[model samples]
Target: MVSIIFVDESFRSGRVCWIKDIVVAVTAENMEAMRSIIQRYRHKRISLAEAGATRHRSIFNGLKALAEDQPDVVIIHDAVRPFVEEDILLRVVTAAKEHGAAGAIRPLVSTVISPSADGCLEHSLDRAKHRASEMPQAFLFDVIYKAYQQCSDYDFEFGTECLQLALKYSHTKAKLVEGPPDLWKVTYKRDLLAARSVIKEKISQEICVVMNTKDEESAGHLLKEVLKKELNCVNVTSTVLDHTGGNVQKFPTDQCYSFICVNVVSSEFQETQKFLSTLEESGLPLLYPVVVVLVHCCDLTLAPLASKMESLMWIRSLAEDMKKRNVLLSGLLLNYSKDEQKLQESFQQGASIIAALVKERSSALAGQLLLA
Candidate 1:
């Protein structure tokens, strides 16, 4: 699924914004499914149009549905290009309002060569002069709608460029706006992995650490302090995980995807399982992978390493099950020391491990337990 996150940095309450409504155009067979998926993310009503067989036809159908609204400007975006930024959207919309049409452009990576009839390279176009046309294009609604109305069958069948139609029918030249590198579309299997990595990095910026006990002197609190130092760039917050998980519920599910569950007095996986349950009930993992690092601080004088490992071996199985739900659960065993210096060192090491897990968010280390 193509996941999109819309951000308006200049948004203000009670102020008019360029985006009035969002509409998704999909095949008739997938309309209902798309509606359900959109409803999960957006509570407000979003219009859905039945798409046509071809690219231009689908866009034409979407435009036809907006005829009644008669919006001043219409922005066209490819669902696969989920990394589109708000700056590009604003620039295109503003340019389109003035120039009648506008579209994003990127520098071409390779030379465009023309092949001869015998399959040999006949000529090559100057790559420096040409730019790749990209999505997040905008047009005057009336101008594009009229252009589509006059489209021939061949145009709907094979024509992919919307700017060309505007220029051909309305004689409107599109203002080309340069876009960022992240505007590239997800087209291959490797692109899917890249998309996930980008999404993971975006969501990993904030981490909510949950402590099972309310004690200020608990090992969880110390870990939280070290985490703050280690992940200085990250926004980290700590809260006591009560029976109802009220504090955790206070955190907006959309903002944070990484969680550190500190189990000091309780049994291993008890607090982590509770946090995971709250996350599961909220359906946050459905949007992206939720990283939950289960941290257990053990005093070797009290609990032997072999016994602790044996008791916590069940986490491997639980991690496997949670992985299916997009919850990456990992365990960290920290050797507790009475000396302040040694304890601080252990906390620092544990914080480093947590930072790596949260940043990379690799599923390969989900079920493994790391010692600090």
Candidate 2:
């Protein structure tokens, strides 16, 4: 919510990279993982602290460790809820500043029941009257810290609610904010699988560019130059692959989030198809959505735009087929102008749209074309 950075702690498999400062609290057994992640981030705002055995104790320990930093507000989040959004975080923080404590809640989906000693249902709770408390809870720094100090050992060992603790010790009534459906925590094995899929979709940021040959005058080469500035150069790579099914040499070894294929003519998509074939055969595991942007460059002053539009229609059909494999296909018609200034402006705009497609990890433009 504030302009800070938060990086994910790599445990078994998942990864997260966000913009916020972070203090990771882990159990003593997970100290090794914490050290490895801290080493990777290497930032002054990022630090580590040991957690206690129980949930409330762990949170208290984390707050105690942060006494020196003296943050204005402290937000407590569970690592399992990977889909916490920026808007929800902002809501909790603002409410906490106004009300001293705040937490997220979702409408209960099922009725809760209590069983008798003989195993028969004794009572049933009205689902409409209850809500499920979710995470990304926030509190005023001083309010929560002092509340923890006043907590009894029994509360520390058995208490599960931070808002209740604040209310009991600091007399602070917590504000409840409704959160989105994606705020569910990963509590089971199947939940982890869902989290993995969500992570793959949102974290696809790396991109690669493919061109037909080594010609500097080619459209792909010129576009790649502009893209390098729009995206991180380390995440963008360029290489040559011939149209006659030749191997694509000199590409990045790591996974690519998107592929930009540049072609001078509208009908020449064989090289792009061959590149896709090679990718399928390489056997490298692709867990994220991969975008394939087809950029067709032609001088619009010399050729009629109507004639070129027909050749690009094939892309729509091809895109529909590629969707089955989780591949998105989009087309960009770079209608170059004879005027140097107009051509330069068009190139800049084209680069921006391509960069947006990659960064947003969006498929809104799939099976569609833009005239740049």
Best of the candidates, TM-score: 1
| Candidate 1, 179-249: lDDT as tens digits | 99978978899999998888778888998888767788888888888889898888988777674434556
Residue 254 C-alpha lDDT in model 1 = 66
Candidate that would win on lDDT: 1
lDDT of 2 at 231: 65
Worst 10 residues of 2 by lDDT: 4-13
- Worst ten in a row by lDDT for model 1: 1-10
In candidate 2, the residue pairs with backbone N, CA or C atoms under 3 Å apart (3 or more residues apart, or in different chains) clash, namely 4-19, 4-20, 5-19, 5-20, 5-21, 6-20, 206-257
Candidate 1, which segments miss by more than 4 Å at Cα? 1-18, 39-44, 212-218, 228-233, 240-248, 267-277, 309-326, 339-345, 360-370
**Local distance difference test, per candidate?**
0.78, 0.73
lDDT of 2 by residue, 1-372 (tens): 322112223322122243234666676787887786556544345556676777787777678777876778888887667677778888988999899999999998888999999999999999988889988788888889899999999998888888999999999999999999988978899998887766754455566778877889867777878777776543667878675566674565356767888773555667566666565555332445677788888888898888788888878887777766667788889967779888888888998988777665565667887788
For each candidate, what TM-score against the reference?
0.81, 0.57
